[model samples]
Target: MSVYVGNLSYQATQDGLTQAFSEYGTVKRVQLPTDRETGRMRGFAFVEMGTDAEEDAAIEALDGAEWMGRDLKVNKAKPREDRGSSQGGWDNRGGSRRY
Candidate 1:
């Protein structure tokens, strides 16, 4: 399982996250998502550790811990919700078209 790290600095880097989490245990992977259009960091990331224990330790140690001038929100990553449709818009308009 991976840990969800939020409220991160936009300048935060994958290597930086790995290094920070490594203090508790081995960091397996770090995913820092970016805005597609802006091509900028989304101020959050997902971190996968070598073991559940390591994840827990990192979460416990890092949650609300200030890093990079921002308080981090760290916890067990929740499964991504399925939005069903990739195309997003006003899908429910009762068949009415408005300008």
Candidate 2:
């Protein structure tokens, strides 16, 4: 299962996540997304665990937990389209200008 972790440190690395989650179980993969332009961590990442139980353990232990002084928000990751931006809105008029 894949879990999403948020409110992460900008300096966090894939290995850092892997090691942290390894306490629960084997980590399939730990991927930290980075901005293409600045090459900086996006403050979130996806971790793939070996099994559902492991995923559950990670979520239970990591959710709302503090790491490097940041409160880690852990949960199953929603797809890109499923996650609306912080602004939270939809354009009923579509992409075109009404003018």
Candidate 3:
């Protein structure tokens, strides 16, 4: 099972999330996004689980729990669809470019 964690603090780290969820059950993986340039926390993350029971346990334990001085929002994650860039849309240009 996979879970999505959101509303995280910039100080939150992958290790911190793992440790926090370890109390409930084993954590398969924890992924925290960071700024591309600054390399700082992006304020959100995702967690992978080995079992549904563990996933539930983790969500119940971590959701609404404060971490890094911020309340965590943990929930099941849906598969992400690839979002293309809007610049490729012809509608925005009103037609095809001749040049």
What is the per-residue lDDT of model 3 for residues 1-99, given as tens digits with 9 covering 90 to 100? Answer: 589999988777788888887787788899887889998888788888778898998899889988778788999988987764545445455886342
- Per-prediction CA RMSD (Å): 4.4, 4.9, 3.8
Model 2 C-alpha lDDT per residue in residues 1-99, reported as the tens digit of each score: 499999999888888899999999999998888999998889999999999899999999999999978999999987667543445355555653332
Each model's lDDT comes to 0.93, 0.89, 0.82
lDDT of 2 at 62: 97
Per-model TM against the reference: 0.86, 0.79, 0.78
Off by over 4 Å in 3: 85-99
Score candidate 1 by lDDT: 0.93
Query: Which residue pairs in candidate 3 have backbone atoms (N, alpha carbon, C) closer than 3 angstroms, thus clashing?
Result: none
Q: Largest TM-score belongs to which candidate? A: 1
- What total of clashing residue pairs does each candidate reach? 0, 0, 0
* Model 3 RMSD, rounded to 1 decimal: 3.8
